[model samples]
Target: MTKPKRFHPFYIVVEFFNVIKYWVIPLALSLVKDELSFSWWQYGMFAILFCLFVFDIIRWRMETYTLTGKTIHVNEGVFTRKVKSIPFSKIQNCNQRTPFLYKVVGVTQLKLDTGMDGDDDTITFHVITIAEARRIQQLIQTKSDSLETKEQQEVEPSVITKEERTLHFSPTAKDLFRASFTSLSMFVVIPILLSLYSKLDELKEIVPIQWVEDQAQSFIVQQTWIMMIVLLIIMVCISFVVGIIRTFLKYGKYEVSSDKTHVYIIQGLLNESSFSIEKKRVQAIVIKQPFLKRLFRIAEVKLISAGGIDHSEAKDDINSLFPFLPRKDAEAMISTILPEYQVISTMHSLPRRSLWYKLSIPSYSWILSTAIIAGLVIWVPALQPYTWLLYGVSAFILLLSVLRKILAYGNTQYVMNGSYIQMKHGGFGTELFLTKRTKVIDVSVERGPIQKWFDLATIVTSNRGKPVLHRFRLSGVPIPLADTFFTWYRERDQEISIVNEDQKK
Candidate 1:
């Protein structure tokens, strides 16, 4: 633990790709120059790449990280030297990712993060062996526990260290099948197929694009009903199979567990990723039921912490409890992971009068479309015969807008129990956001002209998200309830101050 260390030697390769992504397209096009000798720009490119590699070597020599008894120290700078030391007690989350490339090298990247300044919030070891990563984890755990014991001794001299980990949830094969279907991963293949189809003309020298298109049309788009039906069935089967493979690869070996202090998650079959977050660092809990998940009566639960999970794989959103789970399963996970917060089922719905106010809000889309249709009919006399048709389209769109508002009104709800507040709102699908009073940074009540007539108001609360502030709005809340929300948040001042004092201690 006393020895100084640097990143794995592969960092030179990493730096090349970092700059290559920007130059790859130009470089690829340059290859088509058909020049016998290298062009001047090509020479310049090689020189740039060579200089980049040399600088990376210099970087590899200069940067060194040391693991000490109480803190991690990193010293690295090109021109001017800089030093950073982070106490293990301040660490909030840790994640280890072994991407395909890293797996090939038998190494992984480790990230330790805190809830502090963005620049100094995270320290990452871009390349380290798995054993070294595990050793660092153990050090952080032991050091943080000892620090916690000191804090307890400040009040009443007692040490409590319980390292019992319990398995909370793991997806079964059936669960994976359901997740694959609900994820709509089949659509991923369609986009790939369409991309290849669009680019087929580029391969005209080898493949006949027109002939392929004609064949595709004859069997598909410009075909009889029976042929079209058969093609659709084939597509469905292929998409389903693709979705299953994708789901199994990504969600396979997924496990969720927790100890006395942290929630742990490890997933992926090949490109494995594991994340751990302290229970107290969680800022909020979001229960999302998208259109597809809602259809299956399932939801995805996400824990919003200051030191968030990997942001690059945004679709999977690594902080999520499980990308696919039933409502009951997510609820139970919430209770088990963060028992201080509760996921309530029913809340106060919007009163009938709120519907009138919502509907009264003018539809900009309807107005804009109606004007376009009118202009089209007037300018093009050829369209006079189809004026009724244009009007029907406009009416249908307006009807859809009205239907959406009705659905929104029916879904909107709000409730506050003690120190926790939950808000549910959306049209086609619902999102229930729950957070404690101290977690809410801001709260406001808006009573617009229409809302005033109905004695209704919109209550908005803001919380700390991964790297952005997340705001949730609950429309159609009674004015009296809005006052209650504001008051409840205001009461958090004393509690927040106590937490600050504890952290200072």
Candidate 2:
């Protein structure tokens, strides 16, 4: 009913920095304008920066937000003039972020998500006081609570009453250190190194290639082993530093807690964020352990929700209840957050015949490739050296692939509990997926000629999201087991329908 509020004036500085990030070339040009042949480039840079600066200032000035009893409104645009009104009941998540700089200034950012896939439907407050942020959060929670009460009253009186329960969790210093040691970000650094190596042609413009080659030759001849060791140490050190920095920014001071209806997570060192999600909306819980994480006995737990939000989008930690926790602790956390879901069950491993079933395609392909390479080497004289190298490399790769397939088959397992079903499998990085049978939208069982011989089938589970349909797959499962799984899920579906009808009365 009243007028909307604006951000703090200090936000102009924030906008200024944001705009400046895009002016790297412009800034460099300004410093050397007198030495450059094209004076126009310098002026052009200034014009671009000036335009963006003015646009950012106007955009920040025009943006305003308002909250009413039932709806929240946001008005923002430079030329198009967009307006959004989001009802409190439609909001699925409430999150807050505080960058290190913003924290120092006692300001934070608040975001409201409507469970829509695109960010266009979301509401964001760029810069607001911490007090205001907390007040707004309380307002949203109050509305959700009122709506839940009304919905409960509308349902039949015989509906079971769920008691309120709460669980709080935070990582210890020791756990954080172990997480840092197992960080997979080091692999990300490999690509950066390769990219730099690939840009040697670009570097030639500044430093002569001949000089680089000569330096390399001399270093290799004089101190090959010493330099190799030093380089290895340096790369390891750099990777560790980068990994630690990234880990801290994402998970420092992390905390999570869940109640009967909602789960809340808060984390980050440099850019802190808080995420809250309803418990009932979760479609599945996935426990992930990459090689390093598995070796360290830690796992990452994430949720698959029917809502449009994927794990890949915005603050992925929002989907993850435990980014880095001991395997047992992670399972305990999942059980606490989702009481109806349990992690422990008798797992049925895939049949021994499933190994050949899994490896059939890869094995045939490798054999065909090896034959082709052998033929080429026997006929072509020039390709002899390269051909032998290729053959050896291919053989090694085939061996590795076979090993991976065998391990994956051995690790694969599935189980059927009363209300829940779980599938666990992976090549190197493993995933354990658990979901209620009622949440599974569809089930498909596939059998090729080979699978039919082995009496094996691959069962795929479909839920309500893009690209996650086949995520919960039990590959190389025996036909009988697959049939049993299908029957159990179908019965659970019917039971859920009957319960819904009973509640309607």
Candidate 3:
């Protein structure tokens, strides 16, 4: 019999860092001990506590390191050993994240995600070399492929059907730059400039006011043409630098590919990361383009996967598949990648009732701005002019909101085909989502007083983590249509359950 090849010893640098992190509080306390006049016993107790905590982390790391052929087993505990073995077949995605320090040491952290469990169940292995991590990933993929092949053979031919498909690749450099230029970054400059203006008084304290006045005078009078040329050159250089850095960080060596069953995405500059999401595990898809991006014809595509971090704080429930893409090409690619989904047509005009709602007493923007202005007027008399200007601005904003609400009101539609639900929605750039009906966890309907009076309802559909709210003005459609939608969604779930039961038999 041939002997199995042995790999190099697993590096424990990350484990060492984990151990040392526990001493940070004690070390800080020791630094302040002389000033605070701490007792010897207290010092000794702190040291002992730090040591215990450090040991506990080391023990946890040791238990967590695991390897397997068909699965990777991670067992962690200080007191109770909790073992989790995630099968290779269950792994829906894997990603590598490396911090600057890890990059210096040529190491990367691997995160393995199995769609079967929530974000907490995912495993992370830190301080592994990039080459070794890649090797492990490839091995897992191979094992998964073999298992799938075996399972296919064992199942009856009539029971299973293969869905063969090709995938769209990532965009090129030009495409990335075009998309990124239209990103929030472009509009972000205005806020940054305003912040600089707000802090000008503080900045004047750091530099002599006389020096700035002297420079301004010289630029305006003595060297006007020369200063203008220099400023223009500087601005051009800054813009170029910004564009290059943004592209390098976001789309550096971006690649997207797929087999019949999964979509793979690999990207990054300093630290390469990759994600493989099985088709069936995707919960939803969202495509959005801010007003600025719309002008440049660019869109961002996001995927709401069954597994990954929960971004409840930011109210972002989806993760980006392609962070940036040209609007026209992205729409084309979606159709090719997920042909079953149909992009819904966004409304060009709002119902009269929706228009009235926007112009009514309960306008959120008006109420918020009024509160802010009131607080500013009460606290800072010197800022009263600014407050008055803000109040005037709020009136304009309220008008704009009413106009936008009229223009942007629309209903998202979802089509049912067997076990799959195809969803679509967009204001600027269209998005199409296809998810198994069985994956939906909940459904809800909400109405505010204004919406109730206007005969409007906001329908929310949830999967595992959070729900996607679709605001539909009921005045535009017959009441029966909403009932039809609710019925379709409920029946779809029932149909999926029956299908699963039949498959079991």
Candidate 4:
């Protein structure tokens, strides 16, 4: 057992950033200070920051953690202390997050996931040295291994040997290039550009935003076609650069491998990050393709594990197993990681009545909108002259909506084989959800009045997750298929329960 210890001395900087989040109002106030009438508001904001800083100092002094052989204990709060004791056996994931700033400070934040639905039950070390975080992770994993060994020895006295080998994968240069082109992460540049533009006041000397805007407007007025071409070229260049940077930061030298009991993921460039999860902790698998990625025949595979923490904009994105792989390669990778749940694409097609069920709402809404638009043009004398244009736009919108519904209906599928369940959905691109029968926490079959008349239903399966209930839905499924799926789930769950019991023995 290690003695209870305080965080690294440099961790106060990270604590400062925590309090800085509360300084947003003050920051905004400072930006508009010259325009404001009351000057005392600035002083008041300073007072607030000062108080928060003092509060964090006290909280930092009060917080302490200890790692014993079997558990990690955390004590929090300044006056009213709250203690959390997390057993190693309950831990599903030990993930380390190194924000860009944290990397500069040489510290990491450790998150301990316990297959729970809320953060209240999880334990976190907000700031610790990278070395200390890794040591703690190793200790917890060691304790878990010991505990499992003890249980196994108790269950069966006979000696048993299991094969132990490491299966490893690292992205090739070609893979990286493909992933960069296929990544949706370039969309991050939109927000980055917007943020910079918003703070143009701060960058007036460096950027000369007003001058640039004037130049662009003058060019557009003088040489419209040339200006458009130049703008398009600049946009493409910026997007390409941003995509390369994002890809390198995310997948550069990426390595994902699994040992006997744990899956390890390592990636990132400047702020290197690593994460590991027990094989048993994985709840579900999702294979996805964006419309553009699908055109390139690239797919992404992600493992849904229990983590109470939400994926906020500021947090690092979940690193999928393979960010961009050929569709066949992605399936082969899934088989390597989870052999039991083989990828099956031969799904039962829904009846033509299902199409009616899918398009019913959108079709009706389009009709109602068109009717209202036509009525306005016909009754309003002033708008009567532009009736043709209104009709043309309304018809286009109706056609687009109907086409989307048809595509989505045609792609949707539901399949249950043995202990595995899969649901495919989406319109332009497809999303395939795969999970074991034991992973499903709830099953729901919904039928509206219209769906009932058409003998169609929507089947939803909920799996374990945090904050949001992870749901996979198969809409416009035949009523019989829905019933069959529900029955299969019930039967498979029971069978899995028996098998689990046998494994325990």
Q: By TM-score, who's the top model here?
A: 1
Model 4 residue 91 lDDT score: 87
Per-residue lDDT tens digits for candidate 2, residues 69-93, read 8898889887988888889877777
lDDT of 3 by residue, 1-505 (tens): 1222222223344555566687765556555644667778667867876676677556644564556656676666667777677777776667666656777877777777665544345777755778978777776766655554666646653443433435566667776666556553434444666897687675464345768767988767876687889987887667666766766676665776666666677676665566666665566666666666666766777656656543543222124657567667776666666564444443233345655664563568777887887788889889886876878877887777665555444533445565555554443344545555566666556667776777765555666422223221223322344575577677765677787887576
Top-scoring candidate (lDDT): 1
Each candidate: how many clashes? 0, 0, 0, 0
- The sequence of per-residue lDDT tens digits that candidate 1 reaches over residues 112-144 is 977676567778887888888988887788677
lDDT against the true structure, each candidate:
0.84, 0.77, 0.60, 0.78
Candidate 2: how large is its RMSD? Answer: 5.1
RMSD of 1: 3.7
Cα shift from native, residue 411, model 4 (Å): 1.9
C-alpha lDDT of residue 181 in model 4: 76
lDDT at 315, model 2: 45
Error of 4 at 151 (Å): 7.2
lDDT over C-alpha atoms for residue 101 of model 1: 84
Q: What is the lDDT of candidate 2?
A: 0.77
| Candidate 2, pairs of clashing residues | none
Q: In model 3, which regions exceed 4 Å deviation?
A: 1-12, 15-61, 77-81, 99-106, 115-120, 139-148, 151-167, 184-236, 310-319, 344-354, 357-361, 371-391, 410-436, 465-478
Clashing pairs in 4: none
Off by over 4 Å in 2: 7-19, 36-38, 117-121, 150-167, 184-249, 307-316, 363-390, 465-470, 491-505
Q: Candidate 4 regions off by >4 Å?
A: 21-51, 117-119, 151-168, 184-228, 364-389, 496-500
